[model samples]
Target chain A: MSRHARDDNVPLNADATSSRDLALEVENLRTVFHTEHEQIHAVDGISFNIRRGETVGLVGESGSGKSVTARSILGLIESPGEIDPASAIRFEGDNITEYTESEYESIRGDGIAMVFQDPLSTLNPVYTVGNQIKEALSLHQDLRGTAATERAIELLEEVGIPDAARRVTEYPHQFSGGMRQRAVIAMALACAPEVLICDEPTTALDVTIQAQIIDLLMDIQAERDLSILFITHDMGVIAEVADRVNVMYAGEIVESAPVEPLFAEPKHPYTRGLLRSIPSTQTSGDRLETIKGEVPTPNEPASSCRFAPRCPKSFEECSEVAPIPTAVGDDPDHDAACLLYPESMTTDEAVAHHRPADDGGEQ
Target chain B: MGRWEYFLKRVLLMVPIVFLGTTVTFLILRVGPIDPAAAIIGPSGDTEAYAAIRDSLGLDQPLWIQYAEFMRDLLTLQLGESWVVVRGQSVWELVGVYGPRTLWLGFWSILIPIFVGLPLGFYAGLNPNTLADYIASFGGIVWRAMPNFWLAVIFVSVLTQSDALFGFSWGDWLVETQIVTPPDLSGLWEPTQFLGALKAILPAALVLGSASMGNEMRIGRTAVLETKNANYVEMAKAKGVPGRLVVWKHMFRNALIPLVPVITGEAFLLLGGSVLVETVFAINGLGYLFFQATINGDVPLVGSLMFLFILLSVGINILQDFLYTVIDPRVGYDGGA
Candidate 1:
């Protein structure tokens, strides 16, 4: 980014986003799927901001709506799945929740592109890898014929694919798992998106390839100064990539913190459980520590803390009341949505504050 | 192996299967209770006449010699004269007259469904679980459930009667305006002749096409549904591909992978349906000829028609295999693996 958000220019904990130039700012995003049986709030009211040239992490386990949040940013959600109207997804400065389908067609790939998990299924098996990339090029950049073809080859080489000129003519099945992911990343970068939403882009690859892919992403981000919203379940990956992290559980962000402080002195009980579950922390023969219950999915309205069932520090108040995100330490940037903090919203107060989101898309 | 090489190999493979089929058919016909000699020379005829009829048919020769002669005649493509179907008429000459009629009906039957069912299924699949899908699905089921013979009877009855609508007899218009008698297939390219031949075959085609059309619709809906949500399709959308391109450019080819067998099988299915449909309409197509040949123990007529049907079915299957390799890169042309 030519213009970086100078956070130091403003006071540390200012309430609004006026001072820092946010590349993408989301507030009160509630996405749900109204099925025949019941309503599924895939991503409940959650908020975060990504500054230009920085990587922000959205970490959650499977079904915690990390991918849904990534898709909602691009307006990729179809019917039966809906983004609540009150949500504000401001890209750069414009509120994009109001963007029409045609407008989204223009904005996607050009303004913000995406790279998904599972490289095997991500690329079309029928077309040559070069042709798939060229399609995106022609759609957004008006590059066609030889120009598109040359650029596709150049992109493949740039992503470190050996014999790229020849490989570009090959299909997805011909490429190994790692090469396919590299090709996918090359396509996402084709239209030069300002914000890249990578939903577990490296998860499907082996460890060596996974590290290489992350390194490739960082190198590209530095070259172009791209802002990325990296969503993954891996905390180790989050620590490496993110400047700031938002930890989600059951369709809600339970904690938001600068990566170092959050990992060093975690506040939320759920975040603690995640940290402990990492196998590397344990002795070689010792059984790994894991949170007891399955990850909760808040299908109906929840008046109590969503993680209370699996929380090690659960008490009567935790089961009886919801908690609002509040500062856990003097850092001001570190906040966790747990009633353990003295200043946090508890019981009736937190419930009333979170009421507007509960009205959902039904009305 | 190269695609053409594979295709050639499949063609060569067909020879043995066909030979086996013809040999099996010959054995089945010969062992039957109805002896050709008795059928031709009735019970009233004397033993001298029965012996004369048998000699003429070459049935007096040993079974092995008769088989050898039959195989030789088959290899030379000389189907012998019909014993009873057209009395003493050659089988090839009979097929030339009747083959065109049934083939014409099959053409219309197959063509109508592709245009109708493919689009209908695409629409239903795109808007799955909606009212339009439900309506199309219901209609498809009702049409498919009706047997060809039953539906052909209804069509004949409906078109047979002249009804007055807006002072015009639509029933007569449908049945008689373009009814060609004894099929002048040579003039079929002329507009009037073309339409008349088409009209004569319309009832049979509609009945024959119905099941396959419904099948295409249902299978198409399923294929589309399966293809639409594929991760690759979602990747197209994320790449800013327009909706139409996402469906046609990305999803269509993948969806076609599953529908290939269904499309190829429609030919054999229509041929099967043609038997009942031709009998109902009394159209004198190959199906009617086959029916006559079977009952009269016209071995030459039955064998020739059976060869054509076997060739057609095998050819359709070969085409289907070739199509799969063209549509899907994952399926290699590895000499049928």
Candidate 2:
């Protein structure tokens, strides 16, 4: 591993600390798919960091590039889609965006692993669950033969699968959906990867099973102190699991804040709309507020704010210029890309400006 | 049903299929305009001799009695005697002489496709839509489009022509170099003789195999491409399994499941290809024997050969069904539905 000098041209934020606490840092990560006629900017210059043992949630609707962002971190994007040269992905201070395929192999399951959605599809139907986990152990660890099999059973037991010894021999179809997902998670944890990217891991399960999976993940995280990049479209799931939340829309993170503050005082109109759209127990028999207009295709150049067309609080300035990340409220850690959160404006003033005339000035 | 029971049921099912196929073929040949007696006696007036031959062979029996006799002969494995060609030879004796040669050719025909085509298809499928994929796919189509008879002719002319334009003597070299000894067609039952005969049939097998290889390659390539897109394949990669392991361990076995039926179908197709190839290469296989029997209007020989071909087709199908259960656990006969 050659320690190449970092390019000085790329801007670093306050969160870009040299602290050993930081597990992974993604800076200006841009994934573009070049088709015959146009380039689709899937993850356009998205940047965030995961501190060690912290669960950071990336919440977005389908096609918002959340999954692409996760795949990019693992160097999984192939031809037709490319991670741009300007992008930089660092794992524990080592820049890895330029890592070759072979180099990425060493880092992938050893340092960073991923659990994808659709567990039934994720597991090979022909193989026994234990064999799949054994494959992972043998690949990244020196364990093999009986040692590998015993470890695989232990991992299965750790994942809360019942009858671990007997059930390990069963095929994917033999297990229920939640158990399959747990098996997948056990495989991901085989090497005790530093960062585990869960891309909607619980999305395909029943509500009860979803809660069980979430609980299992939380328990595993607590025990292992694993840095988890939890990607989902469900805000409620994020609230339960994430310490920090990054709200993504139109291929970029629009706002990011500590989980509590982001839910209570979302700065971006998109994030606010998302929170409002959730059917709450307090708002029975009322129509849910939806963000108007469809998300624009990423192929179009975002000369102005990407969310301006759908944002309820868009002003004349919103269409004239794109918003850069600016510190919101008193917490400099909370940042949002919206004209409403201009560096000069206070949080109150920004909220007041966006509040419609008909709405009472309760703030 | 238990696995053995299910397997037994599948095997039992073949009996009816083979019986029906043989019956249909027998009726078609027996009721057809071609008279075996006339064919054997020829145009040189021999009415009395023809009548005597018809009576002696039981061709003068009623249609129903003839069918009953045929069925009885089939059940008893007494397939009767060759009438016109090799007049007194039993059909079974002829098969004994020629069966090994055909089986040897069939084995190579199938083996060549698997060994040569499978790897090529796997390679092409690994990088689909690339230049290599396009070339391999296009070449397969061209190979499949060429008729086996035409290919056989081309191969013979190219390998055996000793004079004139583009002269080459690969066939002569094969024999002279003793790389492939001339098969002692008479003693093919002996192991050494059979081994030598296999070498003699190599050219025919290559021609037969190439025709089916095109189809097998295409089937293999398609299966691989489909398996590549399977979610499990992607999951295997995400598990950080090495690229080679992911391909061979995860993808290859899954890909092969769909190719089982194609393989069995190709086995029967190879038999068809062998007929043309055997005639062209002058190999004394069942295919050449069938051709001779058909030309000589040897009813018993032709009937028995047709029965054998039908039996093989049904046997291969049953074997393929059993293989499906073995290769893929998702498919099972336990439900007894």
Candidate 3:
């Protein structure tokens, strides 16, 4: 991956900052999946919070624990998956992480609903779209019979499914990929949940539909004051919707910042590589830059910086010691986990001062 | 539009499938060494008598004309008279009389597995890897492995034997044990006529239903297990649906989708089993008559019986296809479209 020099002059995007009520808080989440011989540390001690009406993006490549983090929050993790006891998932001041299955049942899709990546799988094929949506309405909202049916139709209409009255009677297979996704979104928002975790909800759609879905989510989030944990591998998507972006690598948050700064001046080399790799009109003629190595499965606890093997700017210390997430740059919100930010990274002058002569890029 | 259209298409497709099945049987019967004419004339009849029989019966006619007549008779349900087993009796009339008994046996057989196997399997599935599952699974295997003929014989012999301590036969004991409000000494008198009737067929039905019951049990468990993990099921649970509703509303129907074909396909298996079961139980059902007709070279009787079996099997398969479309909307019969 080529080194991306920070654009020092771009002003901050003010829309990305909002000091609102904390809707959901996740602390020290370490999700591990046990196999016969090893435990896959899928989400390793990651923490973040979404304020009411804010969209927090957990951005990562496949196998980088984004989906696991979402599942863990919902208490949806099944057998072989074990969340570390220290993990705390707080929603509106309630630490729901310790809830029993029945307790979780009351919260899921009521307090915090989710929209999965594949809408076809998310909606039951045997049931009509209206019936499935009514299920959620009845379960969490106490709307029943005609009332639930009417609410389902309304929700479907609100999500932009045309002729909702007619389409509600149809099955999932009868709808197009995008329409199915809309139905799923409608189902998630049926009870007017406070927190919505969208796990790669647009990854299966075409570019236009993806944009539409993102827009629909943002519009709904605004009207409902919904706090969203939008998980995706698409940095472009994170750019479009996320207020605060958490860039995850190998089960750890490598960078966290307001989306604009994270884009314009990514501190962690991994974050820089992710930003540089997105397809851009300016880089149309250039071969796309790619982070060269796969994200390790992390079967063993992190002994050193996991990204050091592929990090272009990784020094000898990167292979010897792991980096913890430390504040980077002047923004109090921004943090990056890299040995380069031994303390809270302060400024570019310090970065340049610390850089070795041979390894510093063209900048 | 797709559902009704698909159902109509499948119903129509049944024509060629049944026709082809009957046609193959016709060709085999016609080309085989057994001459119906000789069988009709018998050993004492002269050569002239044989030729007269052949000519009169249209056995001398060309093969295509015979096949056309056969097809016509099948369509019109004008199956010819029986030759030897019940000489000169109309095959249709014979089947009409005998069909109900076998059907009764079949009904119980079907009901037995659906009630017994499916619930056991589902129970096992609900508590998979538990002791309950293992016991149910093991019992199913043991029952399935017992041959119907052997099991039928054993049941009949065992059921007919007198319980010396009680001074009543096992069958009588069963009838007496039924939860019927009866006169205290009703065991010797009426002992519930329905249970008495059930006693007569229960051994055979149980034996016949055993294999299918076992099969359904194993399959039911698998279907439940597979469907519980399906994405839709997960979605239902994630919706905070009560666990019971999740199983009943979401999992049950999806689980039954796989079992529909397996259950409907049991009809064909039952037909083959009925012959042995009928012989062992001494039930004068169609299967027993079929066995007798086949042994006695009752050509017309055999042909009609075989064709009827074909019709029933084809009908069963059509039912299976229809059930599939009903259970799972995605699986439509798009054949010949």
Q: Quick one: best TM-score, which candidate?
A: 1
DockQ each: 0.50, 0.45, 0.40
lDDT of 1 at B129: 91
- The parts of candidate 3 lying over 4 Å away from their true place are A1-20, A281-285, A343-363, B55-58, B61-68, B138-169, B176-191, B333-337
Tell me the tens digit of each residue's lDDT in model 3 across A1-363: 101112111113224533236788777788999999999999988878788788999998999999999989989898789898877778866788888999988888888888898886877878888999998888788999998988998999999998999998888888888999999999998866889999999999999999999999999998998899999999889999999999999898888899888888889999988888887824566688888979988898775789999999887767655565666787878878687874443434334433433445122
Instruction: Write the number of the candidate with greater lDDT, choosing between 2 and 3.
Output: 3
Error of 3 at B85 (Å): 0.7
Residue-level lDDT tens digits of model 3 in B1-337: 5886777888899889888888888877788877888877777899988888889989999999998998898778888998877889999899877776688788889999999999999999888889999999999899889888788777766665656544766645655432211112224345475566666667778888999999999999998998888878877877788789999999889889889988898787557778888777766688888888877777778888888898899889888888887888777624321
Model 2, residue B49: displacement in angstroms? Answer: 5.0
lDDT of each: 0.81, 0.81, 0.81
* True-vs-predicted CA distance for residue B85, candidate 1, Å: 1.3
Of 1 and 2, which scores higher on lDDT? 1
* lDDT tens digits, residue span A1-363, model 2: 101112211233444655577888888788899999999989888778888899999998888999999989998897899998888899967789988887887888879999999997989977889899999999888789999999999999999998899988877877888999999999999977999999999999999999999999999999999999999999999999999899888888888888988888888889888888887723765677777777777995555778888888887767755566656765556888787765476745554443333344212
For candidate 2 chain A, which ten residues in a row score worst on lDDT? A1-10
Candidate 3's displacement at residue A106, Å, is 1.1
